[model samples]
Target: MHAKLGLFFLFLSLAAIAPLHAAEPAPPTANATDAASGAPTDAATEAATEAQSSANAGAQIPDTLEQRLLACAACHGKQGEGIAKSEYYPRLAGKPAGYLYNQLRNFQEQRREVPIMTYMVAYMSDDYLREIAAHYARLQPPYPAPAGGYPEQELARGEALVRKGDADKNIPACSACHGKSLTGMEPTIPGLIGLNREYIVAQLGAWKTGHRHGAQPDCMSQIASRLSPRDVAAVSAYLTTQRATADSMPALARSARLPIDCGVVPGASSADPELGIAVPEASGESFGKDGKDSKEPGS
Candidate 1:
């Protein structure tokens, strides 16, 4: 009876030990292969499965417009307010949607040539470009303070040129197209405020050098060509000193025609009574065809 009890206990011990051995993971040996065929061992297959799972987990980021546009915030601010004192990047916030759209098209078409900009828009469709433009146009963050340190003479000249043009030089006042307050006119023209002098100068220089182009009969190119180096400097200086206010929002569509024909502005190239477009005023007085002085905000 004692011998029989010892054998039964030994059998129970063997059973427990067998399961423990079976539960332990098998060590993979060199050139290990499946017993049925010459295929990779289960250990290799398990490792591959684990790697694939990790890859799938890494790809789980949400695909959204905001996520795609995170790259833009690197150069332009999160709110589309360009970097302060950056010469190349300008504020996109609160700009007219049409103007912003045209610029994206320009970059895509190589009419404007910033290498990075060109690359960014290379594969974008027109609708996608419009969406991007609209996104930035809707942003209205507070602007950084205007930079100063320009000479008084230059500032005065700039003010004169901006408010009242040099008739003898055939230079129309900037306000004629930019609005009396120097806030941009709606649908096309961009605001001149909140930009650094260097950026403004660089743009004018680009136009002069034929490095930039807009729609045919590009009025900016014409205007830029006519400006002397000193004139450009004066205008940039004055524009950089002005502060943006609550009334600084873009002006409504022009009641009077633009001082010059701009391809970007709808119906600006010709007078279409149906479109309510009028002829440009040589004097840059912002007067309508009916001889009414069409005043703008803050005028």
Candidate 2:
């Protein structure tokens, strides 16, 4: 009876140990193989694993600055070059950062009125505006060819105004602030060349009508207000015909004083928001030719 009982206990112990041994098979000596031919297997699984690893590696990186500013490109061009449909959206590349920053701020502040721009920049901070300005300022993309098909007399009249302002009317030359090259001055002022004729006219119109504004004592407002419709048309026509310089660099200093007290003097347009030289906020106005939102990527 004792021997039979001991045998039964031995059987139970072996059964428990059997499951433990089965649960942990021997470690793989090599990759799994086909039993029939002893050929290596798992080719599909190995390939899948490598593909997954590559995918994970690519996901670890971040997007570029160009990728981040898709909205700007929608109005501006892919390279911040100018584009136009019925409405002309100016090229943003190669402008002074301060100029760009100030324009964006004006739009945000309701000081420079534009409804779409206002909405676009409503949530942005000053630093963010600066970053955007800097990004475009650094990009010196090539300018598009001048689309000139206007009368010679009109273009000539435009050239005269840009080169020599109507002194009798107290309007300084466009080159007075825009530099002899009309490429723009450093710190803030913008170049007049490389813009569309309609955009140029519209912006001047804005300044004249007080629809667009700048820092207090805005020179452009005074200047534009002084310009007749003919003067605006002539100036716009001549400016668009000129090409940008190869350098495309904003000047570090002005060659001459601003000629009048329009608030673009030295130290006037500081980084401080108090200057109010920021953006032209959207004014709930339509920019499309048919009185709707302008088309994307060059409106």
Candidate 3:
């Protein structure tokens, strides 16, 4: 009876030990077939998944047009007033939609030579350009002129140059092409009002330096070359200070004093009753007849 009891106790101990061993999970076996097939390991698969996630995040980094335009508002003002001191960015508000659209296209196509503008426009499409232009054009122009005062004498000088040609230099009055009010004529020309001084100076400088070339017989280039540094400064200063008045009359009159009926002739008026110029119907061969090809590269 004593031997049987001892054997029974030993059997109980063995049963407890067996359960302890059984509770531990078995070591996983590597499948030779999977290894031979060269399947990715769990760690590698995890790493790949993480890399893909990172790539997706990177791809989403560019801002949408609305966001970019919002960023533009900081420097350009809420309504595209343009930076007061920095003339590099022009006031986009109140510009003709077609003019704005062309400029945006020019920047994107590298026809315009501004590095910053090129980058800003690089990824933008035609539709995006039109949308941005339309948004800005619809905004009302800011009321009241810039607070800073411009020199009266300089302003007078600029006005004189713009209204009356410096015949000695063969420089025609800017109004000859830009119109009496300096607000550009319809369908092509752009206005000069509300522009930042820096932009005006830069554009004039570009024309003079050949950095901004236009198509054949570049009018701006010719005019810019004739202008002295003082003239550029004076003109820009004067223009920047002037405010557009609602009562201001258009530059051209119903009748002009030019000898020819051609559109290219200085002082020639437009025939369109609405244009107030006596300009003859444009013969199929006018300078800007081909709208797409009219502008010079980098204009």
Best by TM-score: 1
Each candidate: what lDDT? 0.60, 0.57, 0.50
- TM match of model 3 to true structure: 0.59
lDDT of 1 by residue, 1-299 (tens): 32233223223322332122111111121121101122322332343343346446876434445544544554465677775421234688888666777787787777775655665666666666667777987888887787789899999999988888788788878877777667786666788998766667767777777777877658788887778878888898899888996336776664456677765553444433322322333222222233222121011
Clashing residue pairs in candidate 1 are none
List RMSD in Å for every model shown. Answer: 24.7, 26.2, 27.2
lDDT of 1 at 112: 70
lDDT winner among the candidates? Answer: 1
Instruction: Give lDDT tens digits, candidate 3, residues 177-238.
Output: 55667765433345687775656776777667666544344667778888887787777777
Candidate 3 off by > 4 Å: 1-68, 85-88, 143-152, 245-298
Per-prediction TM-score? 0.69, 0.66, 0.59
| Least accurate 10 contiguous residues by lDDT in model 2 | 18-27
Sorted by lDDT, highest first, which candidate order results? 1, 2, 3
TM-score of 1: 0.69
Candidate 2 lDDT tens digits, 75-109: 46666885554334578899877667767767777
Ranking by TM-score: 1, 2, 3
